[model samples]
Target: MRSIGLILLLCTSLDSYKILIYNSKYGHSHSNFLGSIADALVDAGHDVTSLIPVMNPKLKDGTENSKIIRIEPDQQVLDSYAKEKENYNYFELNSFNPLIAIFMGPKFPKKFEYVCRKVLDEPGLIDRLKAEHFDVYISENFDVCGTALAHAIAPKTMIGSYSSALTGQHFSEFGVPEAISYRPAAYMTSLDVHSMVDRAWNFYASLHHKYCFWFLRLSINRLMKERFGEEYPSVAEQSANVAYVLTNSEPLIEFAAPTMARVINVPGIGAKTPKPLDEYWSEVMTRRDQTILLSFGSVVKSIQLHPAVKAAIVKTISRFPSITFIWKYEEPDDEFAKEAAAKLPNLVLTKWMPQLDILAHPRLYVFITHGGMGSTQETALRGVPGIFVPIFGDQMKNAGMMEYNGFGKVFDKNNLGDADKLTATIKEVLENKKYRENAQRISKMLAKKPFSSKEQLVKYVEFAAEFGASAALRPQSVDMSFVTYHNLDVILASAACIFIFVYLICKMCSRTAVKLVALISGKTKNE
Candidate 1:
């Protein structure tokens, strides 16, 4: 018995690990993904220390078992960047206007660099990181600074977490085949079954994405060199050292794209299990025969919506007196919204609500959302059909996917002021049996996965830490140059060979014809 106890203790000690997580994004959904990973790591008997930006939504306080460190940036710099980000138009990318890219592209990189520098400049942060001696570093992939920080900390292993759906260019960076012919960009509305024009557009979009990132990498590298000294490696080099990437995507829902073995899909990692609604909310939901959840996600506030659009939504929903509408309005004190809510007996206005809990409720008939990836996946998990109003970024693409899958419809945000169109779209979604059927079909397919997302995430993280890096998992293409990786050199060489062979064949034929002509002339002269 003494021997067995000693062996068990040894095994436990061997299994324990220390992990550091960096999540600098201030968005709620982004933070949720990082927080979920931290929680899962802690549950697996690992010590997790999370470093987050002070502007982010407060995560749960650290217990004796785990730690959370918040890094506060210079107040003035943080405020300036926050205001700029708030005003930036993420929707311009979807306008299909080349001029928009020209105007926004240069500005985006500068802003991103500024934010990264500010986060790293936090006092005592570097000293704290140097002392941790974490076995592994996990960070969200949106910011290159996280990758830089990981390199600076010099962890045994590094993992990148992508909170959004997969992008073709992102896959290409790791030498994963993008299959752009069929796989649409996350911001595109193209389908797998595409026409020649669609394929052309996809190819162009893929190139643009690759080029933009290449330019951004150059900019980040210059910034890092200036800040960290010329001896330090570039951001791209740091990114290449990443051993694994975890994506928030499901194969069943997203368009198929080739992924490296190291790229793991753990869709909906941060989604909460359904919980019982509070008494008042439970009573409210019970009173209604049918309920619709209307939320534009965390970034887009309901109170800030155009007055004309708000009036249109109210008018459209009011047409259905029997149905209850639960709007996740951010500002409950807004007099305009309050007055409007008072006039409608069926409308409920709340500043905060348990989104997942409400979505899973039996009364929920449909979800009217802004098509953020988090909300999109959650709705899919609950098998609830949606009416997507995409405002920016990948939201339009997600909305298109929802429509293509027959689970919902995409209502143009430009038509928000049109009550009739909004009413027709809502009516169509509610009355269509195909929409509900497809949603349930997708839900069942996702449910059939062998392992839960949490299980897959925890397993891969542990594997990466134990193994350090998988040489076999790192593809040979990672070592290849851009020309070789894309096979451009091979294509050009093949074209040259074919050209030379064709030229030689034509020359031989010409020489043979000339000899025959000479023989005929000689015979004629002899006669």
Candidate 2:
């Protein structure tokens, strides 16, 4: 493990550019990703400054190859996160159900503005960012205004990082059409969990996301143009033109679309390393026994599980006493705790386990995940088959892709059955050699490349800084007619149809009048 870390450290020496990585939000997963990339860059011998907001942060120069800029998260702003207080409640089936997940698309602009204003006002944060002339700005695509803010301050380029499915919704904002059916890699092909009806709904939901992202981009660009001068390019143009985007996912976990060679595959960047306290490893693999890790992911906590669903899982897994169940319960409770004891002797309940650590454990055999990108990568890297319970967003797409690749199964919350099915699925993954074989094959492919995806991304950042945005990417369709740009083709086609119909009607009317006159004159002459 130390040697692997050393190798990673040595790889960092390959980079020579100064890069500023920004992830001001509080989520551990998001921050961990930023920290990973920054560490890699600094290890490579580049001047790297990281902007982070933690309650109490530790900033030690690990390799003496980079610097850390620590800013206290604005308590005032942190206090205003009233939305964070709301957790998923499975009892309120309305809240935890898949239907509600579709409705909870990307946040609106007002919400984004609220977050942006707080970030800007975080006492000297903006000043600190502007002071450091960054060559490239890297951030999660979901964080609304920070990237735009970075773009405004210096002649820097923006690189987008996201954990899961890079849906049509995201690319469409940059004028790329939604090709929902086009899964770019073998992993995305496995994620076909939707029924015919679910597929249609997923398509519409993805299309809806495109509009949501477009609206947000439009609003951000408009505000930025007034404040910074030039209208910003679309996210797609920005993505395509940027030096590189390092998706924290593998081609084996989700499908990425093939675009102009800028999007790079850098899997496992967000993977969690194994932790020591995972009791399931202790319980199931005491002497090399096989184990299965069950977790719903960070956003969808297991404690939020519907009581019925919990009961079903307990009843089913109770039969498979040989396998270990590491349920990621965010909080502890008497009922859930006792239920674990009653279910199976091999069941080891955990409030939290180092997910990546648990997956990487040698005895681990299967994973039941919410199909998060981070978890997806960990599962792929660990070479484990999965039972996917897709709750929302790209999770649905990811679950579908994994199933498509013969590595997993999708059990929708609405139709998830009894313990027999659950036990059967686990047995199938454990007994069937194909699952392990496929997972290992994909993991090998993910690791075959010489440079980690982040290193390649750093190269792109330097490329963008050296060359202007124009050099990195050209504007696609700049003729900005509001009506024409949106769908003038439809309007033009409609206008042509109207003209033809009018001419045909006029010609028929003239012929009818001539016939009527001729008939009247002939009758009068005969009389």
Candidate 3:
């Protein structure tokens, strides 16, 4: 219930630091994440500026707050993006190819590289940013260019942020813990590790990430050397200075894993408290005892969903006549959507819906989602059970996380069109009391957690400002050789010591027996 406005009033005694948040225009969730940080810092009476490098020519910041600097993508960047977009339909597949998630579609990294080059080459961009004299710099660690830019500015305190759970990806560069024994890798298909085989796969997945991140540093260091003098620091060296990482993952929902004080788990950081509903949705909620909202989010178009899947969803909705369904279909005007809406009065198709408010509705029963981190966190915080059909990225693992947390079920994307199974899954989540109970319990825990996410952000930024990327917070484990970090050297040394001790003992015993046998033989001869 605490408003940012109220927080602003109480900020009179606080010292305001000039902070810059580097944002990418390519991703909706990523932009929304950076926007939330900017707004939060501004609310805390800090001087915050969002420096957005627009990668997608078509995409722009829909909502505006003051102090935003946007560099539009140039023609070359636009052309590259269009070429990349051709292969970007990776998400529109029936079944998720888990292997591709591990490598990450090559096009994105290429496109990001091109975009970063253009942004860096922008006239006066670096000088303009440096002129701000920012004390703090915050950026998502996914793009090393952002970190490189932060290094050029050389803020007193730098912070890295993640929009999704820390998937043990790039933890090496970020200096966060990535022990794979219990932790799930970013691209791992599931959060639940039951067997040694599962643990082994998680370890390999985590290692793959670490290797890729290491290579990325090499790649970016070359770029840094070219841009600045060859004396410029490597990506790893620059990131080593980051004070802390504000992660979006809620710790309570996660399985047991090693974490560092440097990694701040700010659950529901960007999630907004639900606003009051208007007359239409207000009336609609009252019409049914149970209501469900189905959305695949902005990036994944529901219209593009397979015909069979849509049919299965429509069939599932028909069976639940008593439970009203709200579908956020992009093309509500599509013939299939129109026909379905006409046939089923309980099923409503809308191009846009007040998603947060709908989830907060009193009669809200369940949510059907793509398991995007934003949706996953929002649904969890609102105490809504869900059926997740993850198509790509960490979504598959995110779906597993939700199910593991006990508030949801992961419906395989390939089987989404199966009416019997789809209906059964929905009915199970809807009718089962356990799912709702778990959701409510977790939601209450998040709401009443020791620190408000807003407070964590404000307090941490101030802490960093005071101490300036305190190395005391970092573990000595960072930058250790692979053998040393795993203590394999120690293990090998101990094994060798045991072998030598055993060998010496056997040798002494053998010599003693030989001397005794010789003495016995001589005594027998004399007799």
Top TM-score model: 1
Q: Which stretches of candidate 1 lie over 4 Å from their true place?
A: 1-10, 55-65, 85-95, 119-131, 207-216, 229-231
Query: Residues 1-527, candidate 1, lDDT per residue (tens digit)?
Result: 99999999899779988899887655667777778888888888888888765443333322224477766654555666578557754433354556545665665566456666766677777767878777889977666667767767878899877788656446644557777788777556655544888888777766655555565666777777887789888665565667888888777777656777888888888887899999988987887789999998867777666788789989987898999998988777788778878889898888888889999898899999999889989889889999998887678778887887887998888887899999999999999899999999999888888899989988888888888877777777756777998899999999999999999999999999999999999999999
In order of appearance, the predictions have TM-scores of 0.91, 0.76, 0.90
When sorted by lDDT, best at the front, the candidate numbers are: 3, 1, 2
- Candidate 1 matches the true fold with a TM-score of 0.91
Give the number of the best model, judged by lDDT: 3
Residues 1-65, model 3: lDDT tens digits:
47877776667536788888888787777777777878888888888888887887566552256
| Stronger candidate by TM-score (2 vs 3) | 3
Cα lDDT of candidate 3 equals 0.79
RMSD over all Cα atoms, model 1: 2.9
Can you write out model 2's per-residue Cα lDDT over 1-527, one digit (the tens) per residue?
99999988777654456577766544545666667777777655667777654432333322233465555544544444444446445323432234443454434454455555555556776666777777777766665465566555453666666644455444533333345554432122232435565455555555555555565666666666665577655443344444455566566555545553455556666454566645745555564377777887655667666677778888877777666666767665667767676756767777776667667777888888877666677777777788887765566656776776667677665644466677777778778888788888877777676777667755666666566455434325333344665688888899999999999999999999999999999999999
Q: Which wins on TM-score, candidate 1 or candidate 3?
A: 1
Prediction-by-prediction clash tally: 0, 21, 0
Clashes of 3: 0
